[model samples]
Target: MKKFNSTIYMSGKYLFVGMLLLALLGSCGNNADKTNDTGKQKREQLPAQAGKEKAKTIVFFGNSLTAGYGVDPSEAFPALVQEKIDSLHLPYKVVNAGLSGETTAGGKSRIDWILRQPVDIFVLELGGNDGLRGIPIAETSRNLQAIISRVREKNPQVKIVLAGMQVPPNMGRTYASAFRVVFQQLAANNQIDLIPFLLENVGGISHLNQADGIHPNPQGHKIVAENVWRVIQGLL
Candidate 1:
């Protein structure tokens, strides 16, 4: 009888030990599953965060000159910028938002829609129409200010490169000075990059300009590209 009791006690103790080991193993398995699930979630979220570390985007916003006025779209300044980015293998996208005959007011009106995308840089070129139509310089300046403010509201850190325009001397010295000052003052106050004139090399030269004497020819577009590239490269 004593031997049988001892045998039963031993059997009970072994069974309890086995059950405890099984429970510990099950707990470890559950912890491993949880760790794997966490890692998968982190992997899934990685792609979305990847682009932020790649490169920035550039957006060209302006009027007829920006629309490749007299030049082919591929030979335009914006295209040249795209080419530069490609040749350098820079992970960037240059977007053209040019519209022929757009004034500062028109640009202001359309800016909200244009800014719907992720724009890392804005190359602003407007107010030529205001100069042509003899609009008040103050009004043109105000419109441009509003556009800048709107962009700032969307992104406080957005970099702006303003492509300034010079009116014909035929418009009178006072008007021309006012028009130029609109860009100068804004650039100074906002601490943004400024291209003194979009048509620096093509302006007033019949050979470089198209039949309209307003738009630039292909060779002229190359010069414009150089002008823009100078400022953009420095900032970047």
Candidate 2:
């Protein structure tokens, strides 16, 4: 009877030990599954966080040419610039802050409003109207300088590109010549990029202009976009 009792005790103890081991294994497995699940959740969320990144902005501040006066807004040079940036998958947003008949003085006044938002790259395209109106070169120069100073004050890190413009020869050789020199001097003094002549290939070309023979047609705007892209591409 003692031998039989000892055997039964041994059997019971072994059974209990086996059950405990099984329970421990199952708990470990559950913990491992939970860890894997947490890892997978984090991996899935990474792309969502990356997609939230905001694109930098490029503000095109100018007059009728930048506004696409005769053409559709989509046909404007600034819009076309946006298309180019999108095509390359570049992280940039273009804002066309153009107003028709905007002169250097007007730009100086309106710049404060435009600067309320962030500006990564600022393309200045004013002074053309000033030239057309035969505004004094000194006044135009002062206004442009003031606009540039305000832009820098708002954001010292801002990259500026000044669009050079030319008035009709009828404006007078001395006046037209002085007007053309203003852009060069500003670019040099301000140490910013210049597009030499904004309407390079399209300016004097009759077919490239609209009925007003001042603002560019759609095709002309395309060429103008190319001209701008050439200079700004390097900056980007």
Candidate 3:
């Protein structure tokens, strides 16, 4: 009887120890699972955090000049501007929204589509086509104003830069003067920044222009980029 009792007591002791060991192992497994879950959550959040730090966008909306007509797209002034920004390590991404022959009226029609994406700085380079086409000064002004209004409506914080242009003397001095005045008036009235002349040094120079004498060549684009940088650097 004594031996049997001792055997029974030993069996009970072993069973309790086994159960304690199992409980300890289960607790360790739960702690490890909790740590792994936390690590997984942090990994998932990393991309979202990085996305928040992505570069801001600058939209250069214009016509053939901005499109780099008769030249490689990389040789365009907007691309040159991008190169300058990159060289300075600026936190901006330049979007060249330059359609080859877009006028102010056309730009007005499509401004909403362009605004579908976020635009931090908006460089308006229309009106040159309007001048070339001999569009009415009032009509051009109204279209440009409407585009500006729409941009402001979409994003009140957007910084606007209007590029001033002058029609050829052949377009008539009065008409040419009025065309040039439109940009100044709009810039003052809207309280926006202005690029006094987008093609300042490159406009009438035969060597600086392409064979067409209207669009800038690669060398001219470098000067245009400098012109743009002077105006936009302060804003940046």
Candidate 4:
């Protein structure tokens, strides 16, 4: 029998085995990390994408009136709107981004953050604070304009609703009159939806207001909800 060349055969076998293992290791390296990263990306993106599809939001962005300062939040007009939506089996989400004492300028400054997400219907309920603070009428109008412009710029398809608000005559007939007109001008200028007066039948009614004569009582919010619902019903 011929003696086998053990060194050559053994070296060839070992080299083949080594190369196969090297290929496998190179292929498998970081596969788990890659899977985790891809999965993480999917997890991160899924909720926002889902929210866009699943949420039909109405944002009532304003101040104390929107906040329900004198009553439970659920008793607020925005919350009442939500109740109506839910009762009617409407697919809508209400975001009450109402900050107490928020002025038109404040709303303007912070509105970019408010609009970071989807807004189907944007209800502008600001400027009352601007009026109360005796801020210049032109400045109030300009700030409100900027806020509305930003909302339109952010979501062109967003249906805007301007909620008309009035300041007391104590500010003098001229200032008070001009303040009321600001909202009318904005609603016409933007051609957006209008809630003629957020506090219609609720504003001056002593029984409807809290002691502050500013924030509404639960009864007051009910009237407000009606005002809003009447105007926005067609949109829904």
Candidate 5:
């Protein structure tokens, strides 16, 4: 397990370096075919705590996968997680902050706004786009580290879950291997929870994915929810 021994902060120098190193695609545009849900999936609002009573909150932050791009919002894993939370009577609220084409840079820019209120758990699910585009691994790592730092800085007690992702091996064994290592290194360096493979048992499985072969379908999301639930149960 990683050790959390230091208070985190975003170093301006590092952010400036990361910014200079990027020529990545636009953030608000559509996802690539692998990650896109064909732009046909209808978006839905997540479960809300109607009573207005105060409860700890968990936020799912990422791109298409987190957005449930090709599936109903209710079928998203985060929503599934909310279902579990409610059924178990856990004292927590769920917020899904996913966007179809969001990258780590986009996420870093918007994290503070998302942290407007206290959050008990923050699940960081980004970097897939970075790997897909073959952006500098160093830049991807820095952006994620900044995100994790900002989250901790905002809520010192918040538990962070870093979701690991993989690009096709066609990206080259060296690149693919390095990309996978990025998440593991971050998890260890930050001492946060890690989901080794976000698409475990689902990736490369035709039946579990939409036509895109990138984003998971509703059924695939059920397994994704299980992947996350196992790690977060103790924290909750």
Candidate 6:
């Protein structure tokens, strides 16, 4: 009887030891699985963050002129700007957000959303549509002022290049003079880079203009790109 009792006790001891070992192995396996999952999540997130950090963004905000209205996308001045930047091996992306017929107020309203994206530079071109529509020049100027102010407030380090526009001479001398002065005065007061008359040497030239006599053709876009490059290259 004593022998049987001792044998029973030994059996119970071995069972306990075996169960403990199994439990320990199971726990270790679970911990390893958890570690692998965590590592995978971190690896997945790294690429997205790296892509965001690596991308350099530039926004072109303006009216039809910036849109290259009636022109091919590849031949547009913004695309040309991209080409030039690529040729120089600059690490940046240019986003053309120009809406045909957009006035200063239109630009001001949409600027908040536009700025939400990563923008290193803003090629601001507006007021041309306002001038064409015969809107009050003061109102146009005020809207432009607000746009610039808001952009600066949101991104203190962002570079700004303002593109100037001219009212057609047929739009009365008073209106034309006021329209031309708006860009010049704003640029002078704010100490901003200004491209005097975005359509310089191309406007009214039937060869450069499209059928509408307003927007530039492909060849004209090349000239426009040159004008913008002169101002923007220095900024970069």
- Candidate number with greatest TM-score: 2
- Candidate 1: clashing pairs of residues: none
> lDDT value for candidate 6?
0.90
**For each candidate, what is the lDDT?**
0.89, 0.94, 0.94, 0.90, 0.89, 0.90
User: Which residue ranges in model 6 land beyond 4 Å of their true spot?
Assistant: 1-53
Best by lDDT: 2
Candidate 3 overall lDDT versus native: 0.94
lDDT preference between candidates 1 and 3, better one: 3
Q: How would you encode candidate 5's per-residue C-alpha lDDT over 108-145 as one tens digit per residue?
A: 99999999977889999999988888888999999999
lDDT by residue (1-236, candidate 2, tens digit) is: 99999999999999999999999999999999999999999999999988776899999999999998989999999999999999987889999999998988889888999999999999999999999889999999999999999999999999999999999999999999999999999999999999999999998889999888888999999999999999999877
Q: What is the Å distance of residue 201 in model 4 from its true position?
A: 0.4
lDDT of 3 by residue, 79-167 (tens): 99899888987889999999988999899999999999999999999999889889999999999999999999999999999999988
Which runs of model 3 end up more than 4 angstroms from their true locations?
Answer: 1-52
Model 6 lDDT tens row, 94-142? 9999998899999999999998898888889999889888999989999
Cα RMSD (Å) between model 2 and the true structure?
A: 2.2
Model 4, position 72, has a per-residue lDDT of 92
Q: 63-180, model 4: which lDDT tens digit per residue?
A: 9889889789999999999999989877799999999999988899899999998999999999898888889999998998999999999988999999998999999999999999
TM-score of each: 0.77, 0.88, 0.78, 0.77, 0.77, 0.77
lDDT, candidate 1, residue 126? Answer: 93
Pairs that collide, model 2: none
Which of the predicted structures, 2 or 4, would earn the higher TM-score when compared with the native?
2
Error of 1 at 91 (Å): 1.5
In candidate 5, stretches whose alpha carbon ends up further than 4 angstroms from where it belongs are: 1-53
